[model samples]
Target: TLNSDTFTVTKVYSDASSDPQVGVSLACDEGGPPVTVTDSPQTTTGLTADFTVTGWTDATQVVCTATETSVPPGYNSSGTCAAALSPAGGCTITNTLNSGTFTVTKQYSDASTDPQVEVSLACVEGGSPVTVTDSPQTTTGLTANFTVTGWTDATQVTCTATETSVPPGYSSSGTCAAALSPTGACTIVNTLNTGTFTVTKVYSDASSDPQVEVSLDCDESGSPVTVTDSPQTTTGLTADFTVTGWTDATQVTCTATETS
Candidate 1:
């Protein structure tokens, strides 16, 4: 006479509520040959297979083991895969989810001269927001890193950056945004401001000199401008000067000299 026993193997997720249809295989060493069975779509309750034995009085020791063939994306198998068969039932295998990480690199348009600007970085992933300011208080090229381990493989994350305070002579422009990945990067830019000024020349004696040439010198790094007083009238003469890409903190001084 022969006896038959039913054995079962179950697959489960540790971090997820629903099954991800992981692939599993069960191998059992019978008396003569090894019987192998695979589950097409592994469920939480598992699949059951029947095994044949000699009889109830048979002394054959049967061993069954379960192995994972395929796992869900962004997840890893962290459970024990091997088990010994008994009259009770079979074994249960667990799959764990993996964590994801990303980085944000901070940049400035005037990093060469003004690198002490502070910026606020924020990141969100379907949950609470995480914020971090520039490290080292005052430094150039700062970075903020984030690590999230509770999300599934299909989750998406977004990060944004904004200037905490604008510098004296610069204007804040575009912001930074990115879809988070293992290795992602973004940039924020600021533009230097510009303005114009005028230089006026007046003559004490209109008839004394028919025409006079005057040289103007300023603190700004530029060639001196020579203005020719034409008609030598008492009315004031004016010259337009433009300063491009200057900051509010810059100090400007001007001086005039009579060349002729």
Candidate 2:
């Protein structure tokens, strides 16, 4: 008995005339062209010469593709046909006429090195949102790059950056967004956000005991704190306590008592 195998490669042109010439290449788990095929839609066939198929067994499937080496004006050469070749198998490579791109960038503010956290970047295209995490929290400042390539012509993409974890002593710069465009950039900035204040507690005359139990109420009831020492002076705090106690035998007067 004799075996039979047939493989064909076809070219898909952008224009009705198929005025441009294109190069088509094919590769299989076996091997083939490096072959060139010119096509014309004007012709009733609308296809190029078939790639001579050989060395394929009776029931073996050949993996192949047809790619363009050159294309017509206003047409892109990014189209290709990838398929498994079977007996009498044929594939078509179309010329993509139009395309565009979109890019996103993650940037930090010029604030001092107060420690930065990782920022997450999101890109939305084709009605789907994909998120990419930037490098881990930055000690210094840093910038990250993100790009969505090979977009269809005139397609709009949205890019955004948000801090994954807002560091302490700083407030979120908030999420930032870039205007929609084929190839546009989105930038996010983080600024220093904080405030400073001193805490001081005043005590009234309580008891005359040599050691009085002084309590400081800072937050709320049910939660109490005891300050053993009076006149406590810290960088952000200055607590002063006053209590009547035995001063001199002759003069028994209540006065502000302070302990260094």
Candidate 3:
């Protein structure tokens, strides 16, 4: 019959900056002390060279695995364990880290020189919101970039932008859709509050005489109406108002009536 044998388990890191701590569990024909590992730039703990177990029957096999509890930030505990082992056999497990990048873009529909615009970004990963500020008035448009390191691959990362400050005469565009991927793009568009309205003048009588020199006045207290011809155009007028006009003809002056 063969004498008792020994087995060992080792831990390693692809990235030295990854988790510094590792743990292990062993099931063997010959029991041993609790196994634990800690990683460092100089040396990684817990290997046959670093740590070893003794007293297993000569041909008896040993099964070992890396425990996942308390994994370090940005590191995966899913490191694979080496194949089943026997006398004098060794196994190695490796921890991994993740990384990626994303972009954010801001846009305005009108050519207005708004002050600096600020957007807020957040993630479900439990970090504080990141603020991205841009002076659209100076840049014409704005784009920002972000990089994520140590996040698990395939882990859903979401980023959203909200307008914190706006230019004069503008309102917030609200929040945008949460960015779907690490490489995804988030865009926000702001619209000008001011718009144009068309005014058309209709004559009840076509024979009213185009040269009657009709004087048009708007009810907006300080607003001025520009008189050109039959259909005079008013500019820089805001809000709703009533239009009043008069003809130079004395005969029709008294009989002139204002209609909507």
**Least well predicted 10-residue stretch by lDDT in candidate 3:** 246-255
lDDT for each residue of candidate 3 in 11-78, tens digit (9 for 90 to 100)? 56656643445555544332354232223112334322333444434333445443433445656656
CA lDDT of every candidate: 0.52, 0.45, 0.44
For lDDT, the strongest prediction is: 1
Residue clash pairs of candidate 3: 47-51
Tens digits of per-residue lDDT for model 2, 1-260:
33334446566655444653545555555444332222311222335635544555533456656565555544566566666656446676666544333233334343445444366556665656533334223434444454433334334556666767655323456677663463455555554432212234344664333333223322112232222343345432243432211222232222233333
Number of the predicted model whose TM-score against the real structure is largest: 1
Error of 1 at 15 (Å): 2.4
* Alpha-carbon lDDT of model 2: 0.45
* TM-score on alpha carbons, each prediction: 0.45, 0.36, 0.44
Candidate 1 — worst ten consecutive residues by lDDT sum? 224-233
Between 1 and 3, whose lDDT is larger?
1
Each prediction's RMSD over C-alphas, in Å, is 9.7, 15.2, 11.8
How does candidate 2 fare on TM-score? Answer: 0.36
